[model samples]
Target: MTTESDVAYAHQPGGLLKGKVAVITGVGAAGTIGAVTAAIFVQEGARVLAADISGAQKETALSLGPAAAPFQVDITREEDVEAMFAHAVETFGRVDILVNVAGNPGGRRGPEVTVEEFESLTSVHLLGTLLTNKHAVRVMAPAGGGAIVNFSSAASFNIDERISMAYSAAKSGVNSLTKSVAVLHGAQGIRANAVAPGFTLSKKNHRVPPEAMKELGGKAALGRPGQPEEQAHVAAFLTSDRASFVTGVVVPVDGGWSARLA
Candidate 1:
């Protein structure tokens, strides 16, 4: 027998992200950075739209209870991107925050990387970000404000032999777009920022052999890999009131990995 009190208790406003709507794309599988970020947002009382290209978003939203919405979106496509924002507005009434997390490893390297390589990486990281922010600003500008966090990579700084040229180039574009958006829209009450992560360990890459792990850790000043939660925590602050004065900034969530390399 569900009662009104039970319903009231569930909707109770809790600070940190109370009454905020966060649309996070990239939560496909468990133990990924995307899932960790979504959990952190849910913990702080933000209604989430766990958008991903895979069916796994349904399960991710289920774990967060009723406040979360799930959508399958191919960020490379315009219609899919539009539908994602529409669903968020329909379900949560407004989008107070946007997290662009969909990214590909961009492969090791290609014998002869062509325009397709550039298009694939650019579409997901740069164009997807632009489109998401485009829709967010349309909705939030009139409402007076919003926050956006786009993901770059520590690869943006380093000349890593391991990363493909396209991936690195695309992320640099993401960083640039973040700053440009902030500069143009700051006066409108909207804030834009970026996070560049180092060789953060995740289910996908953690299966490397112990020696490889040691080599990877050595790349960071911390002498260890970074956790996804660490990045998520920084993201939470960047998108929250705590960072009200922050905009047009490229924050490095790397484990001092860039510094060590420098």
Candidate 2:
């Protein structure tokens, strides 16, 4: 029985992810990286479980039609995480890709930050990464291995006025976590990697003035803000068989902003 997760391969012409099953979190925003990735994955013939903390994922899945299924999930809770994967297995029979895209960039700068504030971002960015990978690795190990794509950020290492120290530190830990999973589970055929996006614009955050975006974009070597699709395309490559020999690296899709010196 073909499910929504893998049924895309039947109707879609692309076979990049033909017959693959994936659980994608943080697809609540229509133009966010997660949503774009889910759309591309489905286009390439993968069945997707589009999950998020909000009801927006339902709309995204509905818009994407049968290729995507929506699951409301909060990554901070262990029970929610477990149920997310269980549902994926129940619907798809087996999982081949897990894209953990839910994370927050909020926190304090300098010495004024509170512990509670730090934990808030860390819980979403760091703890969420660990919980999803932990569960995903377990499931993939028995299924002859799989691929995991976690969201990192250019702020992880590159200091910038817009970056909160907590966000950077948490994302840095995510990159490290990626490496550990790659090596520890390498023998099991599980490949782990991260995509670090820089200055990506989304329709959900229209509150930011266009001028501010231009200023931020000016900091990058490419002199422009990145579209969500650009980042998603990179993620698609990582999760697809095209990157079969690639694993354990944190790729920067930052438009050269990472290379520029402030």
On TM-score, the leading prediction is 2
In candidate 2, how many Å is residue 123 off?
Answer: 0.3
Inter-residue clash pairs, candidate 1: none
Question: Candidate 2's residue-wise lDDT over 16-134, tens digit each?
Answer: 88779999999986887789889998987899999999889999988888878999998998899999999999988889999998877664687777898798998998889999999
lDDT string for model 1 (180-237, tens) is 8899988888899988988787668788788978887778888888889988887877
Scored by lDDT, model 2 comes in at 0.87
Global lDDT of each model? 0.83, 0.87
TM-score of each: 0.91, 0.92
The window of 10 residues in a row where model 2 has the poorest summed lDDT is 1-10
Measured with C-alpha atoms, the lDDT of residue 66 in candidate 2 is: 85
Model 2: number of clashes? 3
Predicted candidate 1, C-alpha RMSD: 6.0
Residue pairs in collision within model 2 = 5-47, 5-48, 6-47
What lDDT does candidate 1 reach at residue 71? 97
The whole-model C-alpha lDDT of candidate 1 against the native structure comes to: 0.83
| Worst window of 10 by summed lDDT in candidate 1 | 1-10
